[model samples]
Target: MTKSTKPAAKKPAASKAAPKSSKAVAAPAPAEANKVAKTQIIDMVASATTLSKKQAAEAVSSMLDLIATALKDGKSVGLPGLGTLSVAATAERQGVRPGTSDKITIPAGKKVRFKVASTLKGTL
Candidate 1:
């Protein structure tokens, strides 16, 4: 018969989490609108080259696949108008974990590195 007070305790916890969830939901909309997605890029390519959307998409996909294959083979790729991309070896290092704030050792790894061409940097 005393269920009223029992429910009140749970309401505060849910209310505390609601704003955080709402903020997370609200933040992504503007970011998504701002970025040009693959679809938009394909559309642009189609119009610029006078190619059908399907053809443009295939061309873009093939180019990306070629770049990925080159990187996997540890070859440095230099796109004349874009940049140079290469796989760089990383040394083992010590770092702090963000959530737990604990000291941790990060093992050695290979990471992709990009150096923007001077011409591209100037245009940007």
Candidate 2:
């Protein structure tokens, strides 16, 4: 009788580990982002004109203050390169619960609106 050789069993391939969840990712600090944004704006202004960093900062601050004042007085302010800031009136109306259909009355209020400039609109 001839001796028969048995085939060796093959081992299963190892499974790859799952990737880390999105929650495990770290987000950038808010303060750092704010500083970067401010610096970028200042740099852009300074580069576009002869103004120094300090002058650009002051000019931006003043423009923001002016917009705030106009809104506070219920007036509209429009910026050529930025947008228009205006106060919009809302009318009181009957409202309903999104899922349950429960009826209610929504009170009228004033809201601030912004319409972007044509140049900015083109970018979007």
Candidate 3:
């Protein structure tokens, strides 16, 4: 009979499990934090404004359309509780292509900008 000469198995290295001393825990990402339902907004507007669901939807649509039109006309749109939407012109610039030293001219364009309201910023 062959005699077995094996060392006893050792416990896996201490798990990287956090030490219990620290009270801080990793926070959830901003996108995952405090999710609000679209239905809630619709319901609130319908109830508070005393408008039918269809009317509420139309009102919201009109507001958004107005904002879009203003921005298209080179005007800034500001909503008291929401934010400001504006169009900013980007200057043309030369950019280098990836994996190549060749330079390319990027055409100038107008881009929409959003500045969140101070109240909304605090909440986030």
Candidate 4:
């Protein structure tokens, strides 16, 4: 009788398992830090134009309200160089339930869509 002398192969580590370290996690990158908020935009507009902070805030708020109202009325809102916001109708579809083996159905819904203008794309 002949005897085989082969070592068993080792199993690979699980990809889902994360390292259990106590070190502090790193913060998001600088680009994310540079994101401008609504208040900052208002301040910029106030400084650039002949308007106070309160006036700038009111203007910004009114503009947003107008856009939202137009969209709610099933109309498209357009900003000259920015883009257009339109409402789109979606059909009903099927989806799976998370953490379980059961399936579910997702109802039809309306969604907002944005189309970037070529002028803005060139600036980017």
Best model number under lDDT: 1
Tens-place lDDT digits, model 3, residues 1-124: 1233222222222222354323234444455557866566667789999899888878877876888899999999888988988999999999998898799999999999999999999998
In candidate 3, how many Å is residue 8 off?
48
Residue 56 error, candidate 4, Å: 0.2
Candidate 2 at residue 58, lDDT? 93
lDDT by candidate, in order shown:
0.95, 0.80, 0.77, 0.84
Error of 2 at 108 (Å): 1.1
- Quote the positional error of residue 83 for candidate 4 in Å: 0.7
How do the residues 26-50 of candidate 4 rate in per-residue lDDT, one tens digit apiece? 3455556789888998999999999
What is the Å distance of residue 45 in model 1 from its true position? 0.9
In candidate 1, stretches whose alpha carbon ends up further than 4 angstroms from where it belongs are: 1-27, 99-101
Model with the higher lDDT, candidate 1 or 4: 1
Which regions of candidate 3 fall more than 4 Å away from where they truly are?
Answer: 1-44, 98-102
RMSD of each: 5.9, 10.6, 8.2, 12.2
Order the candidate numbers by TM-score, best to worst: 4, 1, 3, 2
Off by over 4 Å in 2: 1-36, 97-101, 117-124
Q: Write the per-residue lDDT of candidate 2 for residues 26-117, one digit (tens) a residue.
A: 35454465565766888899899999999999998887788898898999998898899899999999999899999999999989999999
Model 4 stretches astray by more than 4 angstroms? 1-32
lDDT of 4 at 110: 100
